[model samples]
Target chain A: MTAPDDTLLLIEDLTVSYGAVEAVRGIDLTVRRGEIVTLLGANGAGKSSTLNAIVGLAPRKARRMEFSGSDLQGVPPETVVRRGLTLVPEGRRVFSSLTVDENLMLGGAKHATRGDPAAVKADMLERFPILAERLHQNAGSLSGGEQQMLAIARALMSSPDLLLLDEPSLGLAPQVVDQIFDLIGSLRERGLTILLVEQNVAQSLEIADRGYVLANGRIELQGSAEELRASPEIQDAYLGA
Target chain B: MDIFLQQLLNALSLGGTYALLALGLAVVFSIIGLINFAHGELMTVTGYAICFALIWGLPFPLAVIAGLSVAMVAAFLMERVAFRPVRGASGTTLLLTSFAVSAILRVLFQNLISARPIPVSIPASLSGVLTVGPLHLGMIQLISIIVTLVMLLGLNLFLHRTMAGRAMRAAAEDFAVLRLMGLRANSVVATAFVISGLLAGVAGLLWVAQRGSVDPLMGALPVLKAFIAAIIGGLGSLSGAVAGGFLLGFIEVILQAYLPESLLPYRDAFAILVVIAVLLFRPQGLLARKTLVKL
Candidate 1:
């Protein structure tokens, strides 16, 4: 359902490097509005770096980085969140010391001054019943899937317009992965823009309106999810036999 | 019996001092995860500022305000320039920089002091005396204990009730995640240090008033006590630091009162032994989560 001209993210000559080692090499990519755009790639293919750079985590040289009409090249990560961009970083970095409710409260911080935080929390608890049951428990005690839900819920607390997910299915059981991906589908259905960096290329592409296969810090192929799924290049890249 | 009551009162007063210092240190360290060696010097600087103001014939209240403001501002600047850039560097680097700043500040303070201990005079109304049966005490200790309690309560409320305080706590948990909450990590850290400096400022004024003398090395004992208390309590728990402070104070005072006269000078040594035992036995203090963090 994404129009070709409705761009949500624009990266022009975005070259990110750490000292002599470049991570994202002047990759120009555009994510259209209101769609699940998956960046599928191998571990060292620079997909994570590209996402990190967009979120202001990478220390690099960017010629231009802008999201949804705002300049983001020099902006810090906090400002990126305020401008409606949230990244569920790799490894599910939940605040292990804080309680589940506390984590949700922290996630809802950006929205605090904007409206009623209590209401947002109640709503999030409604959406994730597992979180509601464990609201008072420390996040570290939760199972891996529950932690991922907590992370996503916390990021959602800020009420971000665009959600960037990095490997949400990294270490979860197959059944739990389905639940997480299901949550993603639900989130997307509610009109949340998502730029996902996922390892499960088949499923990610299945849900993705468009997909980009990145290899060695550059985009190897880009097309509709169906087109990319049917291509031999993607099959060779992801499912090498 | 009379002397016992007197020693208990003295112990409580001492506890108040340590609690304030440790609380400030714990709050700042929790946010940034570095032992700010310069924290003691920040206290010394505030004490000198108050002393300097009193020498200039400023009113006692105004002088204290000026001193507290100056200390908070200095700590705020230290964060923006020095700590922010090297925040993610090795802990050793931050420790060295903080120690260097501490030494430099101490030298600067020593230069400003005359040969004599200047009288940090307060208003007559503020320095009233009170008697309880056989124990005679000045109003300053009572005022300090009350103020410390109020500040601790205020801090608790701030941490629990306010949005900014949640940001500060979240920043302590994970800076990257807090950033996703739309908080600038540096600003959050600055706020914490500024509050710490404010605590140092109040503690400094109380210290010089209680002793009625301002020495260049006055900060050493208090800072040392704070570090010990922090280690004995959990390093990250504010309430634990306060409890450790009171406990340290009571231990020191009880030993000073009950120990044989010949061992009087070593009373401080006894309190330190307790600190060491606590550290050896319960290395994580009383409140930290027992998680194995990867270095």
Candidate 2:
């Protein structure tokens, strides 16, 4: 599908390599404004690399990589974040020593061009009551699901226009996974665009407006969620039909 | 009782100096995993700055300000010139870089300034004794204790209260994650160095006041002691550094007070023994938090 003018992130012929190995080999992707786009792939399929490359975490080369109509190539990771693209890195790399409140505070510490940090923190606390209950407790003390929530809440604290979630449901309990997916859906409803990378194929497909299937560091397929869900190739490979 | 009170005050004051220097070391180490052996040189820099300021006819307070300012600027330059180029290299490389910087600065001071210890005269009031009830307190000791506590309190508030400080704390845990939070790595690491420099300034002043002289190698013994204190308290942990410093001070002063005069010459040996015993028992230092692996 042609990218609409409202596209928030645009990537064309993007390549990510670490030394001799290429993780993402020349793939084009787009995330339009206010849409949930899931980039789904199996292990070693360059899913994480794609997300990392977007934020300048990985060595990347691209013909065009734009976020909010601005070139993202060569921008430092921190500057990319200030440009309103925040990543909840794989494994929810929260400052475990810091208390929940401190994590949220650090998240909003550089809330570039956003509302008052105090207000953003209050909004996060209100949305994630569990985080509020354990505001003073170290983030390490939290369970996997709770830490994930705190990680997402912390990302939201930045008030980013585009939120990149990398395997938010990884290592979470099944019920907790449901809660995270629900949270992602709710965030989209609140007008925050998300580019999700997940291994949970079925659930991601359910919530994603469009889906891209990556294989061996390249896009193998791309279509609407409904069409991909109905496709024989998806059902045979992933849906267990 | 009076003797005990005197020793207690001495311990507090001495411990305060160690705490200040150790916390300085810990601050830099925690954020970037660099065991900056040159941290002692920062003290040396401050001491020389103060000495030069005095020689140049500046008032004591103004000299102190000049000393601290030079130390801060020196620290900034140290990072930008030496450390930044070798950043992200192995820990050993960073440690070696610090040693090289230390040696270079010391040689420069020895050749250009004076190889001999430069005596810095202070007001008589700073050297006088204070009588509080039945106890006598050395002026230097009292000031050291007070300044150490105040600096600790200020640092504590900065870490817990300010965004920059919180960013430092976070960077200590996960640097990449800190960048993802929209804070620059250069700024955070630079801030750590500047804070450490300020701490070294306070600590160097105290050390110089007690000695009445500043030498090129004056920082050597105190910084070594501070390093041991930081390790005993848990190297990267700030509170641990303070606790370790105080503990080391108490051990040294108590040893001096209680040991036979003949054994006093070997006091540091006994202190080392105590540190060895503590490490044998805890291994992780007294206050290091176990890093939990995320599943």
Highest DockQ, which number? 2
Give me candidate 1's TM-score against the actual structure.
0.85
Instruction: List TM-scores for all candidates, in order.
Output: 0.85, 0.92
Using lDDT as the measure, which candidate wins?
2
Q: Which residue pairs of candidate 1 clash?
A: none
- Summarize candidate 2's per-residue lDDT along B1-295 as a digit string, tens digits: 8889889999999999999999999999988888888888899889988988999999999999999998888888998999999988889999899999989988988999899999987768898899999898888889999999999999999998898989988887888888888888899999999999999989999888888889889888888999999999998988999999999999999999999999999999999999999999988899985555444
Off by over 4 Å in 1: A1-4, A12-28, A42-46, A96-102, A110-126, A129-143, A213-223, A227-241, B1-9, B52-59, B112-116, B123-138, B263-270, B289-295
State interface RMSD in Å for all models.
Answer: 4.1, 1.9
Shift of residue A22 alpha carbon in model 1, Å: 5.2
Stretches off by above 4 angstroms in model 2 are A1-4, A19-22, A110-113, A230-238, B1-5, B260-263, B291-295
Candidate 1 structure quality by residue, lDDT tens digits, A59-121 = 756656678878888888887888878899898888876788878888877542244677878
- When summed lDDT is taken over every stretch of 10 residues in candidate 2 chain A, the lowest stretch is A107-116
